[model samples]
Target: MKTEKPISEGIMDSLQMKTSFKDFNSLKNEADTLYLKFQRMGFIESELLELKKENDSSYLADFSLGKKFSFLKVFYSSEDFTKKELQQISSEVDETYFILSFESIPLSLKKLTAIRNQKGNAFARVKLTDFEKDENENLSATLFIDNGNVRTVDSIVVKGYEKFPRSFLKYYAGVRKGKIFNQKKLVAQNENLNGLGFVSAVKPPEALFRKDSTTVYFYLEKQNNNLFDGILGFANDEETQKLTFNGYLNLELNNNLNYGEQLLINYKADGKEQVNFRTKLTLPYLFSTPFGLSGELKIFKRDSTFITTEQQIRATYQIDPRSTVYVGYKGYESSNLLDEAIAGTPIDDFKSQFFIAGGSYIKPQNRKLFPVKNAILLDVGIGSRKKDGKSEGQLGVETTLNNIFNLNYRNSIFIQNQTSVLFSESYLVNELFRFGGINSIRGFNENSIDASLFSLINTEYRYQFNDGIYVHSIIDLGYFENETISIKQNLYSFGFGLGLNTKAGLFKFNVANGNAQDSDFSFSNTKIHISISSKF
Candidate 1:
């Protein structure tokens, strides 16, 4: 009696012999007759082997006294029964006591004893799940579309890839199944094909199939752009002296294309005996468009009989991208005879025409120490005078407000109004109401003064530096309304300046001192101004 069985009682006796052989309803008609005489043999259940007779009609079903048998030999045992009736004869009806059979195997090796060698045999062995199912059954590929397009994969055979990577299956095979397959625009044309700085990312390798069209390959990387600059400087104190220079170069195209188109040129020199020449085409994003269309065009020349032609056009209707409602048109023509004696009329064919078909309503607010102080601009116009027909039929209004503190500097307050209507019967110019220079009373000059109820109280201080230097200071008080009667005529002025801005031109060096005395002090006391690139 050698005992040792507790692998959970041999797995509960192999689940009680497979539930007693499926309760053998007679083995379902003997399972095709015991599967053809045990086709590959089975039933290897051995135990009780204590036999002794070679007699008694041939009895010898024993091998010492092992005692563990259950019964096998369906019919070839031949032991007449003596071994004490072969242990009471119940070895499952030992037809003749033959035992030891085997062929049935598989509950994953019932207690697996050991015996391997079958997959194409010769000592067979090779399988980590068949090398991961031959690398998940590799498919084969090649594809690209950086726009120049390419996709061709004729004969790419695949059953299973041996460890992947034949250049990553020829990059997911884009096309080659007879060529010409968009494969869905090869990853968005390789992410918009870019260069110099770098950029790219697009993926879709395989599995968008008609049959199996796999192709993908894109790997790229670089991206940077935004550079800017500006400069200006001008000098003058007369006595045949001077300095002028302005510069700028920038490129930040398509920042939403924010209305940009620039290329301007300007020139000046007192040392070179010449002082003006300009060309321009600029679109500073039309102030901010949504319904705004701004415009500018210019051509200028100097010393060669002074030449200048300028134009400006504008339109606005934001209504709320930050408030706005505007309409504008401006014109200025010159043949420089000192810009038509400072645009006071000899325009040597220098048509001095002014326009302002106006409409304005604005509320611009942006503050961080007065980024735009605050705005409220309202204007109107209707005046024409060519070679002096003085065909005036003009009515105007202007209002400005400001508040700013430090960092360079800023301060401003202004008010205005002008009315006129005289198509000539020359009552020595009977209808005229006006202000001063630089677009109105900046220390007096243009139109000096005329009465019919004019009023102005101005104060300004401005400064800037770094690319386009600037400086401004002004103080003036004006009043008028004595058309041969009623008293109220007062005037005063004081000005200071220095400015030079470039992307092709803008220069001013001024000094003024006025108390009116018939005005026109040839630029108050001293002046020098140049606005090239035709005042874009």
Candidate 2:
């Protein structure tokens, strides 16, 4: 297999020569086959210069392998891009071939035909002609482009769900009329659409290319993304020494009118004293425009002590298929109902107004479940706070991230973190951030903790016996600081749970024990939670 001047390494290994031949003619034929293989591999000047019979069963093969030839020059024309753009691509190809020892001609030819492919030429071909080889083996050839036909998108037809939103075709699927036909992007159309959670792919998208226009077809069915969820908790009160019942309910509606709109209603009655309610509405792609509008309202009461209300309105724009940016105004008002000031600080009425900005990115996860979504959200506010008739500047920030790593078909690990902070000279009791329970740290009473700043990390390791049955272990850690009382503490909790997916809903149950600030775990302090979430 060794020749006079080898083109490069690994070329001999690439030749599929017969190790044992029946006769001398068979050996010659094998050697001849290698020449054609080398020629196809960019050694265009490879030839069998000589063959010598060493003995009855031994032979020496000699060959003249030419310098590896790549595209020293390529000439072509395209209707989509200008001549200068084409020259820039050609110049890039020229730089790719330095000494021309590697066979990369096909890859360069792929680059040559890429523009036409993106410009409605799916079957474009590059034919090299008038090849001229110099003494140094540098070859220059003309590349004649054979662009089959122009295919401009005429329309996108939704088959299964005929009433599916048409605007999503252009904004989400990247398909529209007069747009150039691209097979690669079209092949990925189902993935792009599924990311929005509006619909599931019945099959891959299809294309009907004709001389006049190209028609893109989408086979999809609407998904039941609208959800109703509830969580129930039972625990023993350390002070009261009695069993307590608490829980939360959530209702969300999405794409009801097929315009990608969403409405959420959530309410929580965690304890006898703590009550929370919230509502939000979002309208996307408003009036055939790229902008969206959203409004949110929330109210919280701490049993005859203090009540707080917040309202926000925002405008959103899609930065891409997976991301969105929003800017809005947030307003908060709080009043003392019963509780008095502590630590010599007066608990008075307070109000705040902030201009808020935020962005969100959602990444779909790989999981064998009804819903497989992961997301990240960041929101920050710069505003003014008014307390005791004095106004001061304040900053507020919130961040959340959720990620899932699938180990295999049956196991996974999930991690999520949430942090919220209100930065100011002082904070009122009613205005402080509150968090607890299933949505946050487990094995704790809902809304049982308050702080000016807090961050929580939730980790879960799950094992699935099947798509509908699974078990998981939960470990949560958190830290919070309350500046009003000059207190800071760390929190930790551990728990185990199992889940069952049914036609009515997906149910999960957990038993956990939580401890904070060096407190020892107690069996009486254990909390049990049961949750049911359904999408329809």
The prediction achieving the highest lDDT against the true structure is 2
In candidate 2, the residue pairs with backbone N, CA or C atoms under 3 Å apart (3 or more residues apart, or in different chains) clash, namely none
Candidate 2 off by > 4 Å:
1-38, 41-116, 127-133, 136-151, 231-246, 339-346, 365-374, 405-413, 461-475, 495-500, 509-513, 521-528
1-536 per-residue lDDT for model 1 (tens digits): 11133224643343232212343354343333333322223221223333334543433322122122222232222221233333332234334432222232222122111111111111222111111112544211111111222334334333222222122122222222454434344333332232111122223323222243433344432222222333345555355565444332223322122222344443333322233344444343243333545565654444444555667666655443224455666554654445224422222443434455444333222222122433455555554535454453334444443334444334333333333322322211122343566555555554445555566665556656544666767666666654434346667677777667664444556565657546565543543322322122
* TM-score computed on alpha carbons, candidate 1: 0.20
Those runs of model 1 whose alpha carbons end farther than 4 Å from true positions after fitting are 1-238, 246-292, 297-301, 304-309, 314-332, 338-347, 352-536
The candidate that achieves the highest TM-score relative to the unseen native structure: 2
> lDDT of all predictions, in order shown?
0.38, 0.79
Quote the lDDT for 328 in model 1.
66
